[model samples]
Target chain A: MKSLLTQPIFSFFVTIGLFYFFKIIYTKYPFALLNPVMLSVITLILYLKSFQIPYEEYFEGAKVISFFLGPAVVALAVPLHEQMVEIKKRKSPLLISVGVASIIGVLAAAGIAHALGASSEVVASIAPKSVTAPIAMGIAQKINGIPSLTTAIVIATGILGAVLGPGFLRLCGIKDPLAFGFAMGSASHGIGTARALEEGELQGSVAGLAMALNGVATATVTPFLIKLFF
Target chain B: MIESLFFLFCFLILGEFISTLLTLPIPGSVIGMVLLTVALEFNIVKAETVKPSSKILLNNLSLLFIPPGVGLMVYFNIINEYFLPIVISYFVSTFAVLYISGIIVQRLDRS
Candidate 1:
């Protein structure tokens, strides 16, 4: 039974099954708090704990899905390419927006964490929370933060950004899809980009662009920002 | 589908190779994104070849995030210790980033 459960294929199915099940719930309710990723993670954690299954065993199986993240991220270029005309039209403002937002995101996270009495490691981890997980984790490691902790923080930030970003934009009376996508992608990374895609293709494309640009900018600037602020 | 997937993998691998060679801080996949975009722009790779695969991947992108997210379990103790600060910081800062960036872009677009 343990061997069966530990098989990579078995892990894949369980993850897919659990994710789809929660995904349906999310679709029906369509609430930010009912985020499919958060729900699925909690359920899987509970499932593993109840079965006395070690996380390592689960991870060994689930890593297959994680492996696709690299390719999936690469796929973002497709949408970005599709929306290139729109992006190129306003290149300067968009670039400035991404660069400024990237800096602000890092500083805000680190500043808030520090003000709240977080340890230096925690502050460092939080600094890259707006970037995608792999790059954020890489940045965290460079700054001596626990990469796993940064991964968790990045995920939480993504979900929260996905959930609140659209609503916040609506409230702020920002209706342009491009701006909407840019904000969501820069703040939330891939998950937020996923949400932006659901709104429309143009939004998705811009979100993908934002996510990629912010990832690059954050990776380039985070180490320096950490030194300056922390 | 297979062909598109093949192109994606090829570009991604090439991106990774280049990133490693350059020792760039950016992830290889992101570099792959740039490469794929360039390929698409110049017609080096047809859009149709990668459209289907890229759509499928991007649509379900959130699902790929779960494995790493589940790693949060490992930090339960540290999180528990710093629960308030961590939670508060995440909540406040996330909203702040969203609000500030969104407004900034919107304002810039208006001008």
Candidate 2:
């Protein structure tokens, strides 16, 4: 039993199984709190804890899935490419909105963390919370924060942005899909873009563009912000 | 499909290579994204060639984020201590960014 559990393949299977199980539940219920990533993380942690298995062992296998994140991020260009027509139409406004949102997102997160008495390390981790996990983790490390903590915060931020963004957009009477998707992706990253995809192709494309641009914008600006503020 | 995936991997590798050479703080994958976007825009790479694989990958992009997220368990102690601040910052900041961005972009779109 010990050998079987320790096998790297075992960890791989478990991660995929748990994710799919939670994904099914999320699809059936479709509730904000039933977020698949959140649920899968909880379930996996509990499973390992109950069995007395170490996290390092589990991550050894699970890292295989994580390896794909780079290429997956690169894949965002396809949608951005497909939507070039609309993008070309309003290049200046789109770039301006993404730039403003990126700055505001990082500042707002770090500011809130500082105001709430979080340590500087925690504030740095929160600074990249709006970007996707991979880029957020990289920025967190560069800015002298714990990458693991940044990953958690980034994921939590994504889930929260997805849950709240659309409703708030409606409340603000923002019906344009470009505006809606860009805001969602800017605030939430990949998960928010996933939700945007549900709305339509154009929305999804713009969201993908926003997610990628925000990642670049956040990376470029976060170091300066940390130097000045934190 | 195979060719498209191959192109993506190649671009990813090239992006990593350039990023390391330049010592840029930006992630290579994002650099790869920009590279690919330029390629498509300039007709260096046809959109259809990459579209299928890109769609499959992006659609399941959230799944790839799980391993790092689960790594959170290792930091439970620090997180527990900072729970209130973390939760508050996440909620307040996310809402503020979303609301502000949406409003600004919407107004810009109308203009």
Candidate 3:
């Protein structure tokens, strides 16, 4: 039984199964809090802790799943290309706003983390928190931050953004769906874009654009921004 | 499907090769993404060749993060130690970007 728990198939099936299970719950309930990633992570952590299984043992099997993330990131090219085609109409304003927000996302996140007395690594990890998880993981690893920590923070940021993003933008008197989408996508990434989609088609598409552009934009800025202060 | 995987793997490997040669800090995966985008834009790789794999991967993107995310179990102490700062910075940066970007774009559109 001990060896069975350590078996490669054990971790592989557990990770995939738990993820899909919570994914189903999240799909049925569709609450921002029920985010499949968040739910799945929490449940798996508890199970690991309760069973006395080591992270290394579990990771031996799970790493195979992780290997696919690289190619999956390459797959992002499809949506980025699609959105670029759609964004050609009002390109300047869209690009300018996302560009500014992208810079602010890195600067503000890293700067605030530093000022608040987070250690250097924490600051670096938080620097790319505004982008999608895979990109954030990549940036964090490149910059001497903990990639796993960045992933967790990225998820939390996504949940918070999806929940609070649109209403906050509206409170700031944002009436345009495009503006709303851009703000959500730049600040919160994909999950926030999902929230923007809830508002309308225009908001959804633009938010998708914002999410992709913001990924590229934030990736470019994070290395430079962290070097200045760190 | 196999063709799409082939194209994606080619880009991923090419990205790693370039990043190593240049010693750039950007991850090869991101470099791969950018290169793949350029390839698609210039018709170097037809959209249809990658559409199926891209669709499946993008749709299931969140699943890929689980392995890393669960590693959070090891960072509970860091998260606990810096929880206040993390929470504070997250709220400050997230809303600040949202509000400012919204204002800037709306202003840009109006003008």
Candidate 4:
């Protein structure tokens, strides 16, 4: 009973501690596969498995983290608001980029899934995997995709994009902060936008723009794609 | 802090109810976000009340997924069963977005 009562507190601190630890390792090694979020999650999962801790117990505190997701999403408006003028100026191009990218992303994922003979459900799950969770889950639920599966896929994609996007941009000779930022946001969503912010203000600002546009585009287009493809 | 949490809670529930009634394609939390965004846009909700809690929440957003991802344990043994398809889908789709959108953004930048 004492352990049960203290579980939430323990889990919360464990998460924080693990994150900082992973950050330290990430700084030293800088491996793409050892992304902070990825490493932290793997660490937590391993801890749980080794201890044979039940998920419900672990989630007691973790769900507290989720309760904040709504506000976190709302907070995204801050960066978006700060970048409003530039976003307004390039609204047309931004919309086009997001719309085209989102559609192509869906088709490419779905196409490959079909080619690989993936179950229809797996195809649907991947369809919205690039979008953030709430939207990804919505897309999944709509098209008979597995919502849980989509959530996992979405997080992995976000982390990967956040970690690798900047390096990829540099490799491609794209140095414009706005371009780099927007590309990351459009391709990766919030996680990528967060990473872009770390790169610089200009990158962060434009990345925020991309994140907002991507969300809107994915939400609007997901339903349409489900109909057209399936 | 507690009051702000309650306000967000009520707002989320309200957003869920409205979206559900309309059978909107958007998810409840997203609708909640849009609602809050609009409220902020119109000055209905003061930033002071909203910003504090939102920051705390947003800063730790990545942590939220850990619990869900742990569910992967159930399918650990069969992970490879779907490995090829998931990998192919993830890469192809991601690359598609990158290539096509990259071109469009480049063109727009030129213009």
Best by TM-score: 1
* Ranked candidates (DockQ, high to low): 1, 2, 3, 4
Q: What's the DockQ of model 1?
A: 0.73
List of clashing residue pairs for candidate 4: none
Model 1 alpha-carbon miss at residue A207, Å? 1.5
**Interface root mean square deviation for model 3, in Å?**
3.3
The parts of candidate 3 lying over 4 Å away from their true place are A119-125, A132-155, A158-185, A188-230, B102-107
Model 1 lDDT per residue over B4-84, tens place: 999999989998999899987677898898899999999999899998888888888888888877777777887888787
Best by DockQ: 1
Predictions in order: lDDT: 0.85, 0.84, 0.80, 0.70
Top candidate by lDDT: 1
DockQ of each: 0.73, 0.70, 0.55, 0.44
Error of 1 at A141 (Å): 2.3
**Distance from true location, Cα of A229 in model 4, Å:** 4.1
lDDT (10s digit) by residue, model 2, range B1-111? 899999999899989998899987667887898899999989999988987888887777767777876777787887899988888888888987787777777787778
Using alpha carbons, what is the TM-score of model 1? 0.94
The all-Cα superposition gives candidate 3 an RMSD in Å to the true structure of: 3.8
Tens digit of per-residue lDDT, candidate 2, span A151-195: 878877777776667778888888888888888888998878877
| lDDT per residue (tens digit) for residues A1-230 in model 4 | 54853488887888778877887898799876777777787788888888888777888877776666665555555455555666677677767888888888887887788788888888888888777776778788888988878877777677778777777766776666666778887777767766676676556657656665676688778778877876
What tens digits encode model 3's per-residue C-alpha lDDT throughout A1-230? Answer: 88897898999999999988987897799766777777777888898899999888889999988788788767767766776654566688888988888888888888888998999999989999888776788799889998888977887787678767766777889988778888887887766765565676567557656776788788787888788767
